[model samples]
Target: MNGIILPVDKPAGWTSFDVVAKLRSGLRWRKVGHAGTLDPMATGLLIVLFGECTSSSDEFMDLGKQYRGVVKLGVTTSTDDLDGDIISERPVNWDEVLVRNIVSSFRGEILQRPPAISAIKVNGERSYKIARSGKELSLEPRPVKIHEITVVELSCPFVTIEVTCGKGTYIRSIARDIGELLGCGGSLAKLRRTSIGDYQVEDAWRIEDALRVPEFRGQR
Candidate 1:
């Protein structure tokens, strides 16, 4: 059995499981899996493993990730992203200096709480499952290191950010925390993973294009 590693440009509205299912069908590989999960609302680089490539999954887990995203200030949601139920809306009044200070504060090591709608398992069930049931999911804050975080652009309600961070960092949580720090409710509006470790999104294949590659087609 030949093993192959492919970088995928996952599109929004598709779950990570959806990507795996499509790859399994297109590549005819029952053993296919993804190194990390990307939320349905987010799009970006996904390292797909097939056959013997699955053996190397551990090596891929530690890869640093880069993302570009927009956070909508003055609004809070249950899921910490646009897909969830709205929790509250508050007024936002920030000068450029205040925004810069808040962004800078999150630049290095920080403790962040995972969103309630995350896939993190608690007591053998997904946290999101508990959240959907209308139960409070009390997540503990964990330490995460941000390699770099730059405010790309700032508009009144929407702030664009480019982030490079260690593995396991949740960009959605960052948005939520930033909102708290600025005393304005906020949630992620859009997100895209630009890179994972050495794998750049620019070099990744779209799912359709990946399926058309000779080696992949031959497997089917």
Candidate 2:
């Protein structure tokens, strides 16, 4: 079968691999792969490569991604996002100006610690496995690039930002750090990827749409 690279708009409830599993079951041929993994809480553009397209997956994996997301102050969770258990809370003392300033400061190269419930590996197991076990799990901070971060909206408790970042950037970490700077814990409230490199979510197929009418398919 001829291969093709398909761009999909992954929904919030679906894991990256879930899309692959569904495609494998519903489509002809067998090879299916994704350029990157988006957490279950995230909804965004996911690149699905079939057969020969899978061989070139690395080409798109390093491209920068842009996201529109919300960071809510005064509350924090174990996963640094709303999907996890609330671990702490504090009164928000930040105004719009202060919040925008903090968000702007992150628009460059910075060392960031991946969230505890991340998929990073440690001692042969995913770090999130350790985190779910309620054990101590701390990963070293690594450098990541924030190409640009613009404050889109700010309403004291909720700060909305659009971020364009290089590979390895974590938007959740940005939310957590912003809250810490404001003296109130923060967690990611919402996220949607607008683009990845030249691929836009608007041009991607929704999961349901793909199942019924795939935007791209192989020629057998």
Q: Please write out the lDDT profile of model 2 over residues 132-182, one tens digit for every residue.
A: 998999888999999999999888789999999998888899999999998
lDDT of candidate 2 at residue 148, scale 0 to 100: 95
How close is every model to the real structure, measured as TM-score? 0.96, 0.95
**Which residue pairs in candidate 1 have backbone atoms (N, alpha carbon, C) closer than 3 angstroms, thus clashing?**
none
The numbered model that scores best in lDDT is 1
Model 1 alpha-carbon drift over 4 Å, by segment: 217-220
Q: After superposition, how far is residue 145 of candidate 1 from its true place, in Å?
A: 1.1
What residue pairs are clashing in model 2? none
Candidate 1 per-residue lDDT, tens place, 1-220, comes to 5788999999999998999899899878868888988999999999999988989988888888999999999999998999988989999987777877788788888888999888889999999899889887779998999999999999988999999998779999999988998898899999999998999999988999888876774254
Clashes of each: 0, 0
